[model samples]
Target chain A: MSFDLGLVIEYFPRLLSGAGLTVELIAISSLVGICIAVPVGLMRVSASPTLRNLSLAYVFFFRGTPLLIQIFLVYYGLSQFEAVRNSVLWPFLRQPYWCAIVAFALNTGAYTAEILRGAMQAVPRGEIEAARAFGMSTALLFRRVILPRAVRIGWPAYGNEVIFMIKGSALASTITLLDLTGMARTIIAKTYAPVEIFLAAGLIYLAIVFVLTRAFRRIEARLNRYLLHESA
Target chain B: MFDLKGFGDQLLLGALMTVGLALSVLCVGTILGLAGAIAKLSKSAPARFAAETYTAVLRGIPELLIVLVIYFGSSGLLTAAAEAMGHDGFVELSPFAAGVTALSLVFGAYATEVFRGAILAIPKGQIEAARAIGMNRRLVFLRVTLPQLWRVALPGLGNLFLVSQKDTALVSVIGLEELTRKAAFATGFTKAPFTFYMAAAVLYLTITSVTMVGLHLAERRASRGMPGMRG
Candidate 1:
């Protein structure tokens, strides 16, 4: 009933240990998600209707459902098929870590794609026209003009996505990964101090979010330095 | 090749439960969000600070942790309260209550920002015009603000509704037997995790897709007569 500061203090270090895996999950999934998102996001805004529709369906399915279901589908659903079990992919698929990463990457990729599509579409038409006038090819124009501009525009939203990924990575605990949330649950099970442990865990999450937010603000400022000087 | 083995009805019920939970959270969260937005925009410094802390803490933490904390933490608090009241046995909070409370808090935190932005988007002159017409503060809000707020907040709120619906799946972790929980149960019973989860996924997709269409219609209706605003 009484709050135990000592218990929280003692478990804080253990919770920090789990923070490593949490960060790892977010970092790896987000990197892979960006890779997946860039192509899919480009496809969303592609000139080809087929590419656009295919990417639209991909985004819809992933965004429309819960990430938990996606993770379960990959982790539990896939194993239901004998083919998957016997396949060479089984070794990677059998581990919950890979399953969580795959699901997180796909889910975030869908969201990031939408964000990227909006940013890409919002790129100044004049910039593209100018790029073409300068005799730049499609690839070069995308590389030099559209991609940089879209990234600058999309950075804030993508930062929020990264925060979402951090919060979402907690779901990895459900599939038995000893991420921060899992470690908190394990500590609670042993100590029977759910309130203290969870409170401690929540504080760590808040700290991570706080730090990331500050970092994102710095990056955003740096990215928009040109606009800052123009306004000044 | 996929058989539900008469568990189809259970899955349907679970889907209904999920909707019920999300709807309840939507109602409660909207009220909380309105109050939070007002508090954050209030003149009093403490009210603004309290609102800021509420949103910051709730939004920063993972929803699962909030659920777990409420599930286990509330029981402890309830038992302690009952003890102080001279009750003999331990008290427990139902998983449904805990789920609703946690999810509503999470939803309210996000909705606070949405509502705040929507409120800010209302032209300052409109409120002044209402006041000039001798309308009281309450009347200004009810007659002048609420309608416009709904129009502006609908899209954000609709997105939140979809999110809250999906978040209901997280409640199954605390044993609420929502759609996701039902799929897990069916999987356990039939050893067909793929089929049941796929069914659950399809059911969820249906719910979200239907909700999307409804939101689109609502947005169109809300933006009626506002030229160039209709999507």
Candidate 2:
């Protein structure tokens, strides 16, 4: 049987909207994820035993299990609890969109935290000693020296997390969130042409990933250039 | 309000199924990865391009989408082909076959990079020495290259295997009765989502931890005679 290229063109518009939702899911989740990750990452590197262990446990659990299971736990398990259902948070938890966001955010946050923590630990010890010799306060030292260096070190791996999140956002479809993959699945159901619709969806994902990969590479190069001795 | 009761055996069986699926996918993926790494390293332009395209496309797409597409897409293609051949019956992929194929493709794409890196890590001098000793190409590869390749690739391959194992859960969406699907089934019957999901998570963590320990031991063993290797 021949493939009709026309189907791809005709469905392109719908796929674009689907891609928009995917981008929204990824953008919102990643922003929220980074917000959560910074504190957790910092805590993971903190001197306090309690904070470090707590963050370690959080990362361990999230990274250990599959994202699909986490989504279901949030979407289904939380709703199962009578107290959770009656709580003020229930309104947000009731929606599949919110559940997806929460799950995605937490999952990405765990990964981003680990990346950031690794980067933070990789910062030159002598540089930190130099900063301390200057009598910089903890806050000033962190803001002026550690944070920027950590980000530069972590950016490439963090970029991988972002790419992974884009792919992970496809799981929103499983929870009935009508994201990119969801829309593709819907179209396939209506047209019974899985080959065409899914190919279109996969291609859309490929395009987005290709662009992101290129952007990250450029950013990494710029970051590397800043670190060169001659440039200094 | 949590009780697993009779579902214990089912969950255990599901874990076995998950392991079986992952292992099968690993074997298929390792074969694909070897082929892909060779293609990527080949002198021919077309071979390198094909390998690059394979990794780029497969790695870029979500594994969930791949599973869905392969499950439904192949069935449609197969049915159409059957019809063209004057057959009248339905042609569908069992979820196991589709899951294995999709996961293998996913694992293979990622493993290609790891294998390629491992191959590159082998010293060129060693291969040259083998050639100078008058060993045939196949013998040189088997005796010199293969032994060293596995040592370098083990850690990365192990990590990919962990990812692949968790990905088996995604196949549940297409109706494979792996751990996640088994948990979903239990939740539907017992209406105890928290219990089932929590149990599934624990089960997965157990598998992950055990595998990590095994990999660490294997890595230590592999690095035993190497200089400056640390635990």
Candidate 3:
């Protein structure tokens, strides 16, 4: 019948802690995801059949399933194995944080790999051929030409991925990692005011995502300036 | 280790419910999406504002948040509004309906983008040529633009549908008896969380894989007369 502002304020500390964990998890997983994505992306677009197929399978499996199921499978399913449970890995599986990170990293890697692969392929064939004509070695060609160009092409979509990952970080809560959404749920259960607290957490998420998108836009504009001048 | 006999019927019931809800959401989402897409494409300012606001709010927030907000918050809001309208009875919003509404809103936003892109992608030349032949706007669009537009739009729409279908799990947060929620419930009851989740994972994989094949076939059929295809 009524909403209370005071109760929302009361639960602010718990919500802050949850938000902190969400951000931390996103930061770590994003870094790990990017590392794996780069090579997987390269492999997906590689010339060799064996490398390409393997990468294809990797992307296919993760992308096909929902991230929720994937997280559960890793945390619950993987731990079912005696070798895994009895092995040194038990301590890691016992932690929800590790499971969240692993699932997020793997899922994000698949999507990011595809995004990067498309970006890599969009780099002009003639440009690469010209580099080859100049007698540049493979490593130098990639370092000087391919990587920079791929990043520039991929930056816009990469911004989309950043927003996606930020939202995705909320899923960690379902695994009992006490992310913002989880904290909101807990607070609502305690205070019995669902709208106010969830709204607060959501607003905070919106602010973070808005800032991220703006930062990406600035970097993108700076990158595109060179292209604009070249075209003009 | 798998207790296949005891829970098989219940899991089947859940799977059917999951598919049922996915289709229901898709229908609702399509209606919302068409309206939003039209509104966004309209010339009037109010229409544009309404559509843009819907997209911005829905897109900026996570789908999970939308689900939670609708499932948890909307009932109270609805009840209050009903009382204000001189209604005495409780206006109940079931978790299933709330889940559907949440999903439709989220899917509608993405679909607006897809539909807008598809409309923009229809070639101007063909429309012009049809007009030159004295065809009316409706006729020209139906004959010239719409035909080619489907070929262009189908893949993107298919992808959207697949993603939306998987995304139905967001509703699980609200206790819908969908695949994810069903598995979660069974996990809690059986104390074999891993087995249930694995089954759920495999089921999702099966759906996506089968859909992939279906999409491939559809693409081939749709691209039959296209100029630049390898297959």
Task: Compare the candidates by lDDT and give the number of the best one.
Answer: 1
Model 2 Cα shift for residue A154 (angstroms) = 1.7
For model 2, the local distance difference test gives 0.91
Ranking of candidates on lDDT, top first? 1, 2, 3
Indicate whether candidate 1 or candidate 3 has the larger lDDT.
1
Off by over 4 Å in 1: B78-92
Per-residue error at A60 for model 2, in Å? Answer: 0.9
Cα lDDT of model 2 by residue, B49-153, tens digit: 999999999999999989988997888788998999999888978999999999999999989999999989999999999999999978987899888888899
Model 3 is docked with a DockQ of 0.63
Interface RMSD of each: 1.1, 1.5, 1.6
lDDT for predicted candidate 1 compared with the true structure: 0.93
What value does the lDDT take at residue A23 in candidate 3?
83
Writing each residue's lDDT as its tens digit, candidate 3 over A1-232 gives: 6778787788888888888888888889889999999999989978899999999989988887788888888887787677888988788888999999999999989999999999988999999999999999988998899989999999999888878888878788777878988888877777777888888888878877788889999999999899889999
Better of 1 and 3 by TM-score: 1
- Give per-residue CA lDDT, model 2, range A114-168, as digits (tens): 9999998999999999999999999998899999999999998899889889999
Quote each prediction's TM-score. 0.96, 0.93, 0.90
Docking tier of model 3: it is medium
Clashes of each: 0, 0, 0
User: Clash pairs of candidate 3?
Assistant: none
